[model samples]
Target: MNWTLEVVVVPVSDVDRAKEFYAGRLGFAVDHDTDLGGAGRIVQLTPPGSGCSIVLGRGVVPEMPPGSLKGLQLVVADLEKARAELVERGAEVSEIQVVGQNPRPVPHPLDNVGFVFFRDPDGNEWAVQQISARG
Candidate 1:
């Protein structure tokens, strides 16, 4: 049987703040944002060209704990363009540092596939990677 992963619940300390970051800054589409009938609220966002969507809200979920992880990789088609846009959107993007098991500055082995890292308002480390397709 073929199975597919669907959702990833990112633990967020503040729902509204997260919504703004994921939606306004990163340009993720808010797929679902609503109040949970006085129980809690939910807000979901999907990055452009992303297969999985991130679900984050307060009290919408209980099991996922808030923490920081730096392993999430979101791929883009153009690294430089993505980095520029993220900066324009007010995201605190870090300078393009070396990546992979061994790392170095840009124009390195991964320059063709550019990448930059940043954090959400909650201090969750996230990366934006771009892979160039040579013509």
Candidate 2:
């Protein structure tokens, strides 16, 4: 069985605002944006050169509980350059950090990639990471 991730539902307080942030700042393309009958609104955006998309909408069943989302993860080509680019783009990116618990490598370093965390206007945590390479 070949399972492919298609989309991720990103809950937001306002759809338009989320759309602007994703499309304008993050450079994601708007795929879908509309109403879901009596449910609510739906806005979907796709990242460049990727199969997965992010959906921002409302009226979802069992609407996403607050305080569940920790942050978003992204991958770039050049760690320092990418971080600088985001910072130049007016994004409040944080310093890079490695991930791990044991002392084997001190930190796994996430495939030897660099990662930085930021936040959206709504205080939603997001990240922009960079990897030397990807298969």
Candidate 3:
């Protein structure tokens, strides 16, 4: 049996605002936005070139507070390019920082140590990483 991870539920205070941040600012593809009337509303979006999708909805994760989600990492082939794109789209991303097993300020041995970070409107943090060794 192949166990494939498909969707991740992102808790958001405002569904529409989250939708705008993901879809409009981040350029994620809006797969679906549906209202189940009594059930709730669901908004599914997929990042470009990604297999997994993220879902934002009302009552999706009632126990967890919005902005509690953190350390969601996005792998990119080119870190600088991706960070620039995010900035152009109006995201307040962090400057490129060096990351390694030790997580130091200086450059890592492999160029694989670079990372940039940003957060959604609800403060759900995300990290964009470049690991040439993985490719």
Candidate 4:
């Protein structure tokens, strides 16, 4: 048996605006946008090469205050490249910072320590960390 995290429900105020931010700005692929008629709408998006996907919806998901979710994280091989691409796409991302001491030896100094942060339109925060080579 495997406990896989296939989807995360991101609460947002406006579905269309959030969709544009994830798909257009962050380069996440739009998996599907389904209109549930009286139930609500569901929009699923997945990051490039990611196994997990995020679900955005109106009324079809659990009740959580929009923009209240935080500390969502992502890992990348190159922090600089990822940060640059997000900046180019008009995302207001934070500067790379060494947030903590690395637990294990890594190939690069920034690996496991370097991180950048950003937020969605509704202010749901996200962090991107450089992992480089995963052991």
TM-score of each predicted structure versus truth: 0.80, 0.76, 0.87, 0.97
Ranking of predictions according to TM-score: 4, 3, 1, 2
lDDT (tens digit, per residue) of candidate 3 on 43-92? 99999999999999985445568999998988887888899999999999
Best by lDDT: 4
How many steric clashes between backbone atoms does each model show?
1, 0, 0, 0
Worst 10 residues of 2 by lDDT: 100-109
Q: Candidate 2 on 1-135: residue-level lDDT in tens? A: 999989877767777877887788767899878887897888889977768888888786247753245666767666677667677767777887765443334122554445788876666777766554444
Best by TM-score: 4
Error of 1 at 89 (Å): 0.4
Error of 1 at 112 (Å): 7.4
Model 3 TM-score, 2 decimals: 0.87
Between candidates 1 and 2, the TM-score winner? 1
* Cα RMSDs, all models: 3.9, 3.7, 3.5, 0.9
RMSD of 3: 3.5
Q: In candidate 4, what are the lDDT values of residues 71-131, reduced to their tens digit? A: 8898999999999999999999999999878888788999989999999999999999998
Ranking by lDDT: 4, 3, 1, 2
List residue ranges in candidate 2 displaced over 4 A. 99-111
Q: What lDDT tens digits, residue by residue, belong to model 1 across residues 5-120?
A: 66777887888888898898889999989898878887878888677888887765765546554566787666777888999999999887655553434433555455799888
If both were scored by lDDT, which would come out higher, candidate 1 or candidate 2?
1
